[model samples]
Target: MPGERIEGYATDPSALIERLFQQVAERSMVGLPFYRPQLPIKACAFQLLEGQLFGALLTPWMLQLMLLPGPGQRWDYRRADERLALAFPQGEILFRPGEIAPDLYYLSCSLLSPVDPALSAERAVALAENSVRLALSLPVRQTSVINTGRRALLRGALSANKG
Candidate 1:
């Protein structure tokens, strides 16, 4: 069957991104150099697809990440629209806002363009592995203290009410 959603769990968006990047980087399919950015990712959503891994990260602003099975290349941007004609000869990049949250958006990529549904299981696994490595290598963003505080307060209140 095609379009099978692989089962995976992440503690949070950040954790998920880290796991995915790690998987991609280890494959060494693409040369990924370490980079540290000032802005931290607020959240992320990632998934393993047959020939690609699709996910979005919220850095208080939205950014997308995609991985495919071809020559690995890296692309980064602060404003989504900055690179209108940018194309990933090895892999392409695209972004969209989260359905409910405008500040949040999604990033998607296809390892093999014109994705072949009939792609071999082994190939699919390889692609998925690379995607995960890419996710892990991605820069880790520090969560805002205000947001952390809010979460803690909410958790405490919920527990108190339950008791």
Candidate 2:
């Protein structure tokens, strides 16, 4: 049963991850106060980036960004839940080790914990897709200092940063 596909879905990049979380739900998440039966485990945008896999995940209990080592990549395993930093195109984010199988792990940055029961599955998936896209995009440009002050200062330089 270790590799059983959930809900008859074929293998995906996070299939191992999904099975791991499914085990967790079977063990302890079913009766949690905030656990909603309507919510299903989902993975979004799980594609390789610089030889690693990055994606967003939704479980009945939490929403997170996941980073998994791709083929031939091995991680320097860290203690589960210990804070670590992982960089995406957007920026560096705090992550923690997530154990998928014995000694096999992935990293995750939680976007939401103890997921709200009121959240609908469709909306949750949308949010996960958007989160993945945002995480992989370049960081938003900082506001120009000159724009915050006097406009006449534009004479200082032709461009915002140059001034």
Candidate 3:
């Protein structure tokens, strides 16, 4: 949740997509696909969490620009299966669609585990990179809808809980 902003990239959407994929491919192990509906603001962000977890924050348009299908559709993590599971090393990755907004989603990979102290930081970085790739490559379908305000409040509550 807390990370340094990835810098030195152009703001253009096309350029961002290229750079994002490149970064993820270089640093991660599996590439996973993800989907969501459109949102008011469009952006893509990457964060290195405590040097052990890598996170990618992508908007709906970003997914579309990446040539992935299903913008303006629904996504459900419950439907994800073993094939998706294999993309992540140590099976510690997470795919969380927004509960309130329903338009935002995150793919995160954990590098270090308190319970498994033997996990290496290098392995964690690779898994995180693979997650970004897998997110762009996977297929997702539209499912349901929720109010934007409700989504925002839900996100805020979740953030508060993390804090």
TM-score of each: 0.24, 0.75, 0.21
Local accuracy of candidate 1 as per-residue lDDT tens digits, 61-150: 123454322113222323433332223433434432121122122344323332244444444444555554564554556876555587
User: Candidate 1 — what's its lDDT?
Assistant: 0.38
Cα error of candidate 3 at position 48, Å? 16
Higher-scoring candidate on TM-score, 1 or 3: 1
Give the CA lDDT, 0 to 100, for residue 86 in model 3. 22
- Residue 71, candidate 2: C-alpha displacement in angstroms: 1.2
- Which residue ranges in model 1 land beyond 4 Å of their true spot? 1-10, 13-104, 132-163
Q: Of the candidates shown, which would achieve the greatest TM-score relative to the real structure? A: 2
Q: Please give the distance, in angstroms, between residue 154's alpha carbon in candidate 3 and its true position after superposition.
A: 60
RMSD of 2: 7.1
Find the number of clashing residue pairs for candidate 3.
20
Best model number under lDDT = 2
Candidate 3 lDDT over residue span 49-145, tens digit each: 2222233333322222111112232223432231222233333334322211132222323322221223344443344445455544546668787
Structural RMSD, model 3: 21.6
Per-residue lDDT of 1-163 in model 2, one digit per residue for the tens?
2332212112346666767788889998998887878888887878877877788889998999988777566566566747987767877899887665562366789998877778899999898899999988887787656554555665555576774
Clashes of each: 22, 0, 20
lDDT of each prediction vs. the true structure?
0.38, 0.76, 0.34
